[model samples]
Target: MSLSGETIRKIREAIKSAFPNRDELVMMLRMELDIPESEVPDGSNYNLVVFNLIDQLDRQNRIPELIKGALNERPGNPDVQKVAQEINAIYSNLSDKPLLKSFEFDVVTVNAQGWKISRKRCRAQYFTEDLGNGVTLEMVAIPGGTFMMGAPKNEKDSFDYERPQHEVTVQPFFMGRYPVTQAQWRAVAALPQVNKELKPNPSYFKGDDRPVEQISWYDALEFCARLNFTINVTTQRDYRLPSEAEWEYACRAGTTTPFYFGETITTDLANYRGNSTYGNAPQGEYREETTTVGRFPPNAFGLYDLHGNVWEWCADTWHKNYEGAPKDGSAWINDNDNPILRGGSWGNLPVLCRSAFRFYDSWAERDSHDDLIGFRVVCAFGRT
Candidate 1:
């Protein structure tokens, strides 16, 4: 093992005190250490020299007795005992430190050209979580950036709530590739509670990869809390729901269009109603029921089902507009109903599936949940 420079210096001092003549000390230590002449440097390799001397002294089995004698002569003299401790510490550290390991994975993204799978670490674009129990969650690494949030004026069927569009700066984080699937939700819900208990299979849909719906806003929070605990044990950090601004920022993925792919979205690109069309795009097929997660293409950030599939619950409370919204992407929590839903569901019109769309579940009926609304998870992570 390589010894610290300071440790080497202290070792040299010990050797010098033991033998005053440098040449004589070198000859004796070289023989005792069994170090070849080729390996010995004229002045350097003092660390090695010290290490061997300690080993030889230890083999002689006199260090403990020496410390005992010194303590009896002068309590805590820090002479022989201190030197022995330093030698022990240097050796101890060699066995204590563990080697670091590395891993690699892939993700998919969209651009002006089309969807492309990437294994490159270009934006540090990577997020793959295995929640265990036959349930794994895929996510995309969202690089932090500033963007103009909310639907623009003159947009088709844009609501007043989406009006007064404002800019938001979201920090880098990992967002689920799709809405929380039944399998993912069941796995998290089965974990031991942190603050509250949960029903393992709360979704109205019965499929594993299908999005988990019919869950209350409070239930979503509980699921996240359980997920936070589970992931924290694996990575020593927790997960959370994305703020409304963060959801919008990641959903846009650098696009100002109504959808991440373009000005209009179709069932081929998303899972929203197929009979209707938006912008100048042609009408397409609409599946009346929830489709499997990742049934369509992903956004530029490699996130799927952000525009449709299921309405994702955001951590923000219901707000009218961006008049006094937060600039940095953070949950705008209030005492009122604390859940804000975004991304249209399978039963909604294409207009409601716009990237800037927003909705909220009924607060008066906490237990109420429709088949149209479900949520995904987000976490502040990755090398920043």
Candidate 2:
């Protein structure tokens, strides 16, 4: 594909941002292109380094090869993969043959005692939504499946609200790869308001990559509404909060264990309070603050931070139990004013972070902002 000067400039800026470390840049260049160490530029000027590397790759007609190498080497780095996907989209637009894109990742599991059980490779398809100003949102395709949607009675720390361990059939849908980050929140907040006005910076921890907390359930709805309004013009897709069933099914990722990782969770796997341990798991560090999204391993479905970081708001209204929950993967709604919250938060215990754990705030407190609250988005299939 022939990249114009403007396209080249954008790619250079993206590459520089994705790889700011001089050593990492040189390592990628040497690993991808097999460039001799002496020939590579050495300096703190990442722009110059990226410029030379891109120039070399363009001259050799090996830009695509470099992108592939980056994807393979840094699958967890969303910025790198975002740049690759953007370039691939450009190539697809200009050529008859489109480049192959993959979302391969490593899935790890632990036993009841929190011991490592297994590790396997998995892959899923995803699409990127450009939110402008170099920030993008990644939505992974969750496969349709039938799974038990709640905690087993014998499970430790299981609650009545998570009881009845009934079966639920969830249809295929797309979900955010991580909890909504501050950068993503800001981008969508800047969009023309759909209902309520959003504060540009509402998070307490304060990092562009950290999950946007202090967001009420209503604020999350507005974010989705604005996003749908903006993207539906071109894609005709509806973006909204995930249903309670869909949230549990996606978080479990076809696992019956308390966590997608296995029987127990530790501070190493999630961002909950580390002073408390789940099952036989040992106590770990209490970071006392939110870490960047995707700082931990993802589930089998390629979704990250589903266990902790912040509680994710769901589309369902607060219910006492699964007595009359929906069998199909749709939100259970009624005249209730309170909304359901899932996935626990950084300040919660490991038990609260369990996959089947469910929580809700009072109707009077529904609009109140809590630093422990945030959300991710879901897009149904066939909307386009």
**Candidate lDDT values, in order:** 0.67, 0.81
Error of 2 at 179 (Å): 0.4
Give the alpha carbon lDDT tens digit for every residue of 61-150 in model 1. 533333222222232333433554554443333322112223232334333233332323323255467676567776566778999989
**Mind sharing the TM-score for model 2?**
0.73
**Model 2: CA > 4 A from native:** 1-100, 382-384
Colliding residue pairs in candidate 1: 274-285, 274-286
Tens-place lDDT per residue, model 2, 48-151, is 77788788778877776666556545645666556665665554343221122468899998876777778999997787877767998888888898999888
Model 2: lDDT equals: 0.81
Which candidate has the highest TM-score of all?
2
TM-score of every model? 0.67, 0.73
